[model samples]
Target: MSASLSVGARDLPRTAARRVADGLALAAAPTFALMAILVGAGGSDVGQMLCAGEQGLQIGGMTVMYMLMSVFHLTPWLRLIQSGKREAA
Candidate 1:
């Protein structure tokens, strides 16, 4: 028996954490866009409009970042599972 070879249950909590993080990031863009649009439509001052725009951009960036992370995390797990099934066949 090889000492380094072992199989155990997957870390479900970690997977859930990653999924939640990804979801939050995905949601950030729309949330920010809505906020900016609402604020702009409310007839606020120039400063407020600028602030909202900047915030919207930041939120969109965060959303992209998180979505990328989600893809990265999910891809590997899916590949691993597929490979295992292929090997078993």
Candidate 2:
């Protein structure tokens, strides 16, 4: 039982890391597409403003989402560490 539990625990972090990486890739795709379009459109002032605003929002939103997801992914580890410290105390 302890061995199985240890194996499960080891798998958990790797699975969570894969999920976070997948999520980052998913989040980045649209941002990259938008950037490509913006670049191809030739930075006329109007085009620049429009694309800049749109890309800014998209990238910023993705950045925030990534940060939140990262925090969420770390939460379990953090809790485990804190609990360990408490137990040690």
* Best model per TM-score: 2
lDDT tens digits by residue: candidate 2, 8-73: 999999999998976665555455555544543443456666766743333344445554555545
TM-score of every candidate relative to the true structure: 0.40, 0.42
**Quality of model 2 by C-alpha lDDT:** 0.61
lDDT of all predictions, in order shown?
0.56, 0.61
The 10 consecutive residues of candidate 1 with the worst lDDT sum are 1-10
Q: Which lDDT tens digits does candidate 1 get at residues 28-54?
A: 555555555454445345696686674
lDDT at 34 for candidate 2?
A: 52
